[model samples]
Target: MYDIKALYEATSVDDACRLLKEHPGSQVIAGGSDVLVQIREGKRAGKELVSIYMLDELRGICLDAEDNIRIGSLTSFSHITKNPIIQKYINVLGEAVDQIGGPQIRNIGTIGGNTCNGVTSADSASTLFAWDAQVEIAGEGYRRVVPINEFYIKAGTVALEEGEIQTAIIIPKKAYEGYKGHYIKYAMREAMDIATTGCSVNVKLSADKKTFEDVRIAYGVAGPIPMRVPTAENFIRGKEVNDENMEAFAEKVLEDINPRDSWRASKAFRCHIGVVMAKRACEKAVKQAGGDVDDRTEL
Candidate 1:
């Protein structure tokens, strides 16, 4: 067995940062759901563990001064799913959170841990990336923020360096207003399956019910990272979305997606599902943004 030391608890972000500096071999542990599993599987063996879940500064969610919603790094998936603000507005993100594990895991697994742990299959990440979310990094000397897309360097890899902790996630105000989106997770079963296929769509509604505006679509477990679907997005942007635009967008999904492994689903299955999901999301969002009645909740 590997030798290890547990620091018991951390009271605040400042306290946690200090401990991280003092214990060079230590790894910050919160939500223990992911880290504990890794430790048991021998995927990681750190000399010390600093439990930070108790740190008040690292938990909670709220809109910041700029009206951008900032989700505390330690905020649980349950919190994300239950927050009326998130549900009433950023429904795409709320939908993603709802799919994360069962009730037990949802109560404990956190967004910070999900992003930092860097799992390819993390469901929340796809929506976060789609929104061009930003991350607040806390450290001893200073704090800095980076866009979510830039935060992850690679699969299971991130830009988090020495003495830094992901303190919060910030979603810009505009991304939250006049926005509509849908998230679909193609798993073996809705209850306990990792996404074989997952997709999120975000669209900016034009004041007039005619033209489509900014569209952002993304997928998970499809490639090395969560990414915007460029080809499909471009196909429908600025156009008067209709059955024709949806069909064209669907065609683009086939060309745009870059599938990696085969487990989530066969390449063909994911590609087909990606195209179909994108079309459905685009139609629903366009309808809503234009102030029309479209009762389709495709997710």
Candidate 2:
């Protein structure tokens, strides 16, 4: 059985923040998919937990007055995958989260927990990075926003301050408009296996749909944190969509990733697969954006 000191049920967002502030060292629990497993594994065995699962304010998807897509932290993977806003605009994010575990896990696994756990192999992390998402946080009487890049401090770590909880994930209008994206999760098995490497790429074609106006490529399990290769993105920003440009862009990613040798896969294997995923994901993303790229070319 899992060991825990106590559980405090929070009734609202303010209540949750108050509980977090009042009970120092208490861990926040929402959707328990990650926390419960950690507790059972003895990773968080004796810690006090404050449950925010019932906080309705932290659960919805909407577009704010600024035209940013605001996704509540408590939104489930299943809910995000089926949301019309996600399907229409940033479908790559939806597709990425959908590949997370099985149906039951997706139903209860929240995007907040998935992100806050700070696992590099998380399915949603890469896409969020690629989309230039922002993390909105609330603590006591203050709220702040952090870019996705700065939000991730390192492997299994985020930039959350004491008593602060992530309230929403915001995808700004400028980040998603005119962009088409794709996600590829390379895993040992197709069903419920975790990703050995996950790649997310998005492209915004020029008005004529002939050249790339912008590109973003990110990878999970590629380094200490899910990160985008700005060097590669810069190289392909104004380049014509073609086999040569795609290959070069994929090669550039190798300079940024520092995957290590692990039981699941070796460092060399992860690097090679990461490049292939990048190329393929970019090609698919370009196609979805109505840009012509030679898909028959092999790396």
Candidate 3:
């Protein structure tokens, strides 16, 4: 095991920021679920632990009077999974959180840490991407906001600059008000496997369900990053959820996702699963949008 020069449990945002500046080499830890194991496995190394859990500024789940849900950075996945606001407004996010690791891991892992870690299998990442979520970041001079889709530079790396802390994750109320979505992960096993491929679909459909208004799709574990499926999304928008459109949408997604080597699954299987997951997720999203699509119909 590696050793750390110090461990700081910051009680406030100012205190946390001060400690972070004092030890530039320090790594911020909230849940310590993924990071601690990564450190012990020699995947992540650091000399200090700056605990952000005690920072009251980084803890809580609340709804403002405006109906927008404001989630603190340190909010746990379990907390998010159970939050009624999340359930009612961001069901896809809640669904993704429920499938992460397990109840015990969920209880400790923070939603902010999951996406900030920037791994492709991060359960909540693509869900946020589908919803057009925004991450709030703060640093020395001021704060900045970036859409969730652009938050990661690469695997295991966040776009957050040095000394900056992600203050909150603001999921806009508009994304949730009249829309609905579904998240589907294709994994070998339901319990422990990372997604071979995962998809989240969000849509606003006509009352008759014959046509769609707005549509969004995001695919994970398909490329250098978890990403939005723009080609697939474009094909589904304004199109009827018929067999022809489903096939066209699947073909569209095939153009974008090419899976890579992973210990748990083969590339071909991953590719196949991505296509299957995308189709199913899209259908479910359309249904949730109050669209009248018979899922039993062939694609």
lDDT value for candidate 2? 0.91
Query: What does candidate 3's lDDT look like per residue over 1-299, in tens digits?
Result: 75456789877776777778988878888888877887888765556888887766676777868766788998998888788888878878888888888778989989888888888888788888888888989875587888887788887788887677888888778877778899887777888668767788888887777887778888788876888888888877888767678767866887888778878777887777777777777778877777766665221
Best model per TM-score: 2
Worst 10 residues of 2 by lDDT: 290-299
* Per-residue alpha-carbon lDDT of candidate 2 for residues 166-253, written as tens digits (9 for 90 to 100): 9999999999999999999989899799999999999999988889899999999998899889889988899888888899999898
Model 2 segments beyond 4 Å from truth? 297-299
Instruction: Check candidate 3 and list the clashing pairs.
Output: none
lDDT of 1 by residue, 62-135 (tens): 87788899889889999888897787778778779889888888999899998886766789988898787999
| lDDT by candidate, in order shown | 0.78, 0.91, 0.80
The candidates, ranked best first by lDDT, are 2, 3, 1
| Model 3: residue 172 alpha-carbon error in angstroms | 1.4
Model 2: number of backbone collisions: 0
Candidate 1: TM-score?
0.91
Query: Order of all candidates by TM-score, from best down to worst?
Result: 2, 3, 1
Return the clash pairs for model 1, or none.
196-264
Q: Among these predicted structures, which one has the highest lDDT? A: 2
